[model samples]
Target: MSQGDERGYGGNEPAGHTDDAYSTLGGTRQTRTRLPRGGDEGDGYGRRPARNSRSLIMVVGVVVLLIAAIAFANQGGGGDTSGNGAEKATDAAGAGPTAATGTKPVQGRNGTIASGFAHDEQGAQSAAANYAVALGSAEMFDKTQRDGILDAVIAPASVEKFRTTLDKAYSIGFFRNVGLNDDGTAPAGFTFVSRTTPIGTKTTRASADQTTVEVWCSGLIGLAGEGSTKPVTDGWFTITMELQWVDGDWKALTHSQKDGPAPVGGDNRASSADEIAGAVNGFGGFTYAR
Candidate 1:
């Protein structure tokens, strides 16, 4: 039951009936279809050791069940590695206990996510796979890229209380029920489509400071164009993070989610809306590590 949070927001944008609010703490599971039973990401361990009184941990971060892919020009999301790319990222579906162990990434950044890692346990599983792609991206629905990604992956003594409970869970009724606006963007000629990739990672507790790491994601939210009505979709979940190593790398004190190891959705014929907004604007996302 604890493969733990990964990719699904989707685990992001909430509105009317969004579930998968990161597993427990008033969780209902649905893993994302709309979102919002409550989010900020779940599981911080033992519930609370006064982690800023845990107000929705990262709030709306369980990415607000897709924050509708918090459009940084709709880029692709990806991270995680073990060996043989984790058996082709679980497709061959056999020899994967966390694939792809070429281990390259991690030069260092922070402003745009990925930062210096390697302090062990594969650098806290590459800082929990790029902090679960900036906690299920689409920049957590704005507010200045969600306060610069909670000051680059939270945990500076719980960054201003997770920016005041994710600025009230990205309010304005979560940007008009996940359609976005009121500064969350995506209105004219819409294109927004959130993304989170990962697919492998596992630690369940490491050293050097702290670690939990459990990625296994696969997210992509809605809104392409053509009279948009929340079109885009792709989900699978698991995201339990609890990293530490602060002031140098690996942040996030918590972040939980769940739903699937997911695999079984074929028919392969659903790309439209301007070819899914031209493959999410000619794809270009990758900073996450392993």
Candidate 2:
């Protein structure tokens, strides 16, 4: 079959069902899970993608995560190589193939997410992963922080454009409408959390200085608070990013997302508000690869 055929999402399928939509379109065996025969579950790849296969991707990504770690893990913990007290950080995994040899490593880490970047596919993937985190973060619900993120990661040309639109998306009325304070603050005794965890990333297209990356991200978006009507909820979205090897790192040129490409969620018991809050504070996010 043509790769496109393998990835096509035509029937009742939603948008961005990479495996179904993409496989039908490109005939690549990209999808890891089987879709429901027809109806919205197999809507193809136009609007909302399928959500019943994400766990499969997570399983696959765990392998990549291990490989990436081995490629960079040091032998004896880590020794100081920077002449200063700090140990020189290792290069990002999966970067040598695209980067000029010996290019310095890129920095990464944001408030619970990863940021900064090196100059190759690994770096690009890292950037894409983190950008997905930032884009899906609760910060996006705040105007000032959202603008700062746009300015920091967005391609220079597209920043102004997306910003104008996002301004309306995160407006005061929008926040109030969502049960947030007019200033985008959470009410007392409540912890607002919005996070996207990347399952995997691939380079659909690439150039020495540019790359088109696709990230399969499973995200949780909802309000967390006692007495809240809308509790924490989850969704799956795929983010496609166009990145340029800029000044010293990869910067997003354009990014768009579509929903679905999801799988049916397992029947795990929902945790209480306090339990969720404790988990959020105890665990941290990771710098993704694959």
Best by the TM-score measure: 2
Q: lDDT tens digits, residues 188-285, model 2? A: 66667677888777677666677778788887644465555334556676777777765666667666555557885564667886787677668877
Every model's TM-score: 0.30, 0.61
Report the Cα lDDT for candidate 1. Answer: 0.59
- Model 2 residue 196 lDDT? 85
Which segments of model 1 are wrong by more than 4 Å?
A: 1-134, 139-141, 148-152, 155-184, 188-191, 195-201, 208-214, 227-242, 245-265, 268-290
The clash tally of candidate 2 reads 43
Q: Can you tell me which runs of candidate 2 are displaced by over 4 Å?
A: 1-105, 108-116
- Tens-digit per-residue lDDT, 93-181, candidate 1: 33236655787657768677878887667877877887787767787778888788878886676666567656765666556545666
